[model samples]
Structures are given as structure tokens and as C-alpha cells.
Target: MARFEEIGTATIPGDGTRLRLLQRNDEFSIKVAGTTGELMNSRLHGSEDALATLACDRIASQPEARVLIGGLGMGFTLAAALSALPQDARVTVAELVPEVEAWNRGPLGSAAGYPLHDARASVHIGDVAELLREGKGSWDAILLDVDNGPEGMTRKENNWLYSPAGISAAQRSLSSDGVLAYWSAGPEHAFTERLRRAGLSVEPVTVRALRPGKGARHVIWLAW
Candidate 1:
């Protein structure tokens, strides 16, 4: 078996502990406590690209739009979102952990070529949920790729982002025609219902990005 190498470490804000970032060949993994999880599976690819593409595709009609992306995981989504939008678009990225933000700004940036350097990118080092509560009708699109999904999660507080109240807050934050998109590891019918129950037009789209040639399945839920 290939040995996993220690890439670096970062502490989760307010959690008062540290998490380990690891690498096994091309795969990037994170471990909270003793359990290991892949932050970006080189074999499966990261799901961030799917969420970004879905949201950008929905907001392409707007000439100068504002986009809010939750989570700055390896910057795959940020890179994808930047590529999908017009130069006039502005993107505000909210990340919960300050250390995670630092990682992206430093070493990880080198790995990904620092996509946040784009003129349109702004990084907010705080909880995305609090950012969502600032006001109503603020963003043209909100793409959430913070966790695994509504059903399977890495953190407890993240569950609020997918709950009935969280969906309602998201609806309020969206412009009249704004789109809210989420990337899940797999299909989540209950979450789709919650979006509809929140009075947004919901659609499910699956994407893939696996092997160099083959593709991986990515499930996206979009709400307006």
C-alpha cells in the first residue's frame, strides 16, 4: 500500500484542536481527530467544480453579477467559477476556518496556482452562515460546497446550512432570480424537497470528473 504523507496541519477555528492534511500519491486527504477523509480524492476528483459550474451556468445571463461561494476547499470551485463567469462578475468566498484560509493562501495556492488572485475574487475568513444572514437579495448566485452534503456531514454546525431554516435564509439572501446551488456526494431527495418547500425552483443535475478520460458522477441541486 502507498504510504500517506503528512502535507501540513491547520486548526479549526473555535474548535481548539488541529486537523491533519495528508497526501497519498496524488490524493489529498484530511483527518479530524483519528479518522481520515479525503479532502480531494485524486481518483474521484473534487466536487467543487460541479457546484461552481452549475451556479455560474445559471447566472450567465446577468451582465455584472455577484456570486457567493461557501467553502474554499482546494480552490477547484473557485477556479471553475472564475472561468465560467464574465470578467465583470464579483465573487465573495466565505470560509469558516482561518487556518484553512491560510493554507489556501500559502502552500495550497502554489498547488492550484492561487486562483483567488483573480481580480474578481474576495476571501472572507468567517462562517458562511453568518455571511448569509447579513441581508436579503444580496447575491445573484450562492454556491455551497462546504460539506459532503445535507445527509452526510463533516461538522455539526454545517447541518444548519441544509436545514429548513437554512434554506429559508438562503432564499432571502438571493436576488429575485438568483440561484442557490449545492454539491452533494450523492442524490439527496429530501434536500430537493426542502428547496421546493422554500419556494424556489429546484433542479437536479449530475456531473462527472474522474479518470483522465473517464468521468465521476457529481450531484448538484439548484434552486431559484
Candidate 2:
């Protein structure tokens, strides 16, 4: 077996948790120092892409659609959104960890085709929740693949994102007919109910982590 080589490490800004980047042969993965396990893997990003694709497909006809992406993990979601959206569409990617963004621009860029360099994509090194609060009725679609589904695995603050208040903020951030998408490791019925309570219709989709019917099942919630 080929040993995994440690590429680099970064500290999560607020909690001081260390995130280690590792590469095994041609594959790359991100893992936290503590109990949360692997954050993401370069080879498994089907659900992430689906999160953006499903939402972008819904709003593809909207002229000059503005999309907000929460989390820039592996840039799969951003790349998929750019591919699905029209030339006039714009995408804003909010990444909490600065090192993650650096990784995407450096070692991991090729894995997702260097999405950050795209003219229509903008990278924000901050919390997506804050961005949602500030951008009122600004986004045509909001795709959130942050922190292992609706549950917060990396940061405690992420819990607010799935809460009633957070769902409300996400709802307000979208334009009428806009969609809000969420990616999770598994299903969360309570989270689905919360979205309904926020006045948005919800659709739960189970997608494989890899294409062609391979890998574990992941869930994507589409709300509008």
C-alpha cells in the first residue's frame, strides 16, 4: 500500500483545531486533528457537485443569476455550478478556513479544474452564515455543503446554520423562485422539517458519493 504523505496543515481560525492535508498517490484528503475524521476527499465529490447542479438547473433560465456557495471544499460544487449555469451567472464561494482556499489554489486546484480562477466566481474567506445575513434577496440559489451535512462537525458555530433562525436567514438571502441546497453525509428528518417551517418547500435527494452507482450514499436537500 502507498503511504499517505502529509502535504500541509492549517489551524481552524476560531476553535484552534488543526486540519491536515494528505495525499496518497494521486488522491488527496483532508482530516481534522481531533474526532471529526476526514472532512473531504478529492475522489468522492458527487454529492457536492449535485448540490450545485440541482440548484443551478432549477434557475438556469434566470438571467444573470447570482449564486452563493457555502464551503469551497475541493471546489467541486463551484466547478459544477459554473458548468451548469449560464455565462451571465455569478458565483460567490464562502470558505471559512483560509488554508482550505490556499489548498484549492495550490495542490488541489487541478482536481476541480481551478474553479477559483473562473471570471464568474468570487472567493470569500469568511463564514457563509454572515454572508447570508448581509446579502438579502441577492442570490438566485444558495448551495451549502458546509461541515458534514446539516450537523456541524468542524465548528460548533455551524450548528446555527441548520437551526430555525439560520434557515430563516437562508430563506431571506434567496430571490423569489430561488433554491437553497444542502449536502449531508446522511438524512436528517428534523432539518427537513426546519426548512418547511421556514416557509420553503424541501426535496431530499440521495446521491452516491461517486458516479456510475459506486460509493456511499449521501443526501442533498433542495429547498425553495
Candidate 3:
């Protein structure tokens, strides 16, 4: 077995929390400084890919579709979205952590094929919520893979994105027929209901962390 090697560290903006990056052969993992498990792993990104494809597929044929992606972890979702959209489509990704974006542009990019360099992709170095609040009807699809979903997440601030107001903000950020997708480590019934209460239809999808039939299940909520 290959041992993990510490490669780098980054500090989260708001509360100054730290994230550590480790490499084990070709695999990379990002973990909160004092946490037990990884926040992201390059090899286990099935759900992350699904978070983009499922939403992007819905708007692939829309002429010049606009997409907003939150949390650029390893660029898996961004890469997946770019692959599913039309050539003229525009995709904007917002990543709260500056270092996270830097990591994506560095050697860490190989895991997800460096989607940032794609012609249709744009990067935002601020919170996704800011875009949701400011960019009304700006996207044909919005995909969020921030923090750890809606429950017991490490970042308390991310909770707003799952709140009733947050749900409303997300809805307003999208075009009338647009779709919004959220990625989580597991399913959160309350969050699903909140989406329902917001009057947007929601579908909870279970996806594997690794390849099909090989890893733990993660949840993706698609609402429109």
C-alpha cells in the first residue's frame, strides 16, 4: 500500500479553518486540519461527476445555456458539466477557497482533466451564495457541492444554502425552466422537504462515491 504524503495546506477564508492536502501515489485527498475523514478524494468522485451530468443533461440543448457551479472540489463537477454542455454554453464556477482554485490549476488538476482551462468555463473566487443572491435568472442550471451537504457539515456558514431563503435564492438565480442540483455525503430528508416547501419539485438521487457498484452511496437532490 502506498502511504499518504502531506503535500500542501490552505486556510479557509471566514473562520480561518485549515485544510490539508495529501497524496497517495496517484490519489489525492483534502481534509480539514483536525478532522477524521477527507472532504474530497480524487479517486472517489462519482457523485461529484453526477452532480454536474444530471443537471447539465437537462439543459444541454438549450441555446447558449448558462450554468453556475458551486464548490470546485478537484474540478470534477466542472469537468463533468463542461463535457455535457453545448459548445456555446457558458459555465461559471464559484469556489470560496482561493487555495482550492490554485490547487485545481496545479498538478492536482490531472485528476479531473483541468476543466478550468476550458473555453466556456469561468472561475469566481467568492462564496456561491453571493452569486445566487446577486445573479437573478443568470443560470440555466445551478449545481452545488459545497461543504458536507445540509447536516452536521464542518462549515456552519454553508447552512444558508440549504435554508428556506437559500432555496428561494437558488430558484431565483435560475431561469424559469432551469434545474438546481445539490451534492451531499448522504441524504437529508429535511433539506429535501425544504426544497419541496419552496415549491420546487425535488428528486433525491443516490450515487456511488466510486465507480458503479463499488463504493458508498452519496445523494444528489435535483430540483426545478
Candidate 4:
């Protein structure tokens, strides 16, 4: 096992605290200042691989369709979605943290091969919540990996995106038969109900990053 090396450090704007990024080959982690919230390599909870799989599976059916991916997180989800879709598909990724996006297009791009910079990709440096509130439709698929899950990893305010109003906004942003998939660290029955209540046909898919070698399972909520 390789050890993590410090890549770069930055302080969250407005917030006085700082955070450091670490990398061990293709795996990466983040250490939050004055906090124990150190995200480990694409496993042990903050698994970017799992997020990618969940997002990709939901948009596999729509060729030449428009897809919106919330959160760039390591660019895993965006890259995976691009790989699953046809050449004609377009992916719009909305990321709140500009630094994360820069890290990917720079040092971390090698891990995922700079997929977000691909011709089919459009990067939105903004909040996913605001995007939802804009009432933009015509998207064939919308993948939300914004928080650690619907329950959130870092911010409690993210919980609103899992709320009834947020889900409704997501539904409105989708095409008639469009799919909406959310990646959560754990299951949330209330969120599932919210999806259905928002008029989407919902299904829960359980998956793992490693077939037999890895521990723990993650659930993906697929709503269409």
C-alpha cells in the first residue's frame, strides 16, 4: 500500500479553516482543518468509484441525451457517465467548489484521464441547488452526488436538496421519462418517499465497489 503525499492545501473561502489534499497513486483523500473528517481513498465510505457506478448506470439508456451531474467530487462520476453514454451524449456537471474542479483538470486528471475536459463535457462552477431552482428542463438524466448522500457529509444545509421541494425541482428539470439518480452513503427511506411523491417512478439499487474483496454496501436511488 502506498502512502499519501500532500498535493496542495487551501483554506475554504469565508471560512477560516483550511484543508489539505492527499494522494496515493490513483486514490485521493482530503483532511479538513480542526476536524476529523478525513475522506479516505475511493473506499471506506467516500468512495468515488461507487458514486461513478451509480451515476453511470442510471444514464445508460439514453443515447444523445442531455445529462446533468451534480458535484464533481473527483470527477469519477462525470468520467463514468461519459464512458457509459454514446458519443452524442452531453454531460453538464455542476460543482460548487472551484478548487476541486481545478485539482481534477490539473493533478488529479491522470487518475481519471481528464474526462471532464472532454468535448462532451460542460463544467458549471455553481451550486446544484440553484441550478435545480432555475426550473431548467429537457435533461434526460440527472445524477446528484452532491453530498455524502442525501444525509450529507459536510454541510447540513444540503439536506434541503433531499427534501420534497428539492426533489420537485429536480423532477421539473427532467424530461418526460428522464431518470434521476442519487448517490447516498446510506439509505434514507424518507428521501425515497420524497422522490415518489415528486412523481418519479423510484427504484433502489444496492451495489459495492469491490465484488468480494471490499466491505460494506451502498444504495443508489434510481427515480424515473
The best candidate by TM-score is 3
Model 4 lDDT vs. the true structure?
0.75
Candidate 3 lDDT by residue in tens digits, 143-211: 998888886376788999999898889998999889999989998899888999999999999999997
User: Using lDDT as the measure, what is the rank order of every candidate, best first?
Assistant: 3, 2, 1, 4
Tens-place lDDT digits, model 1, residues 19-50: 77667665566667566555565345445677
lDDT of each: 0.79, 0.89, 0.91, 0.75
Which regions of candidate 1 deviate over 4 angstroms?
A: 1-3, 24-27, 209-216
> Residue 174 deviation, candidate 1, in Å?
0.8
RMSD of each: 2.4, 1.3, 1.1, 2.7
Ranking by TM-score: 3, 2, 1, 4
For all predicted structures, in order, the TM-scores are 0.89, 0.96, 0.97, 0.86
Question: Residue-wise lDDT of candidate 4 within 1-224, one digit each (tens)?
Answer: 88889897765443444667788886777777566566434444334455555556656676678888888866777877787788888889998767878888888776667887799998898788888888778788888877678876566667888988888888888887677888876677888888887777888876654443465576778888
Which digits, one per residue and each the tens of the lDDT, describe model 2 over residues 5-37? 899899988899898988887788989876446
| Per-residue error (Å), model 1, residue 91 | 0.7
Candidate 3 backbone clash number: 0
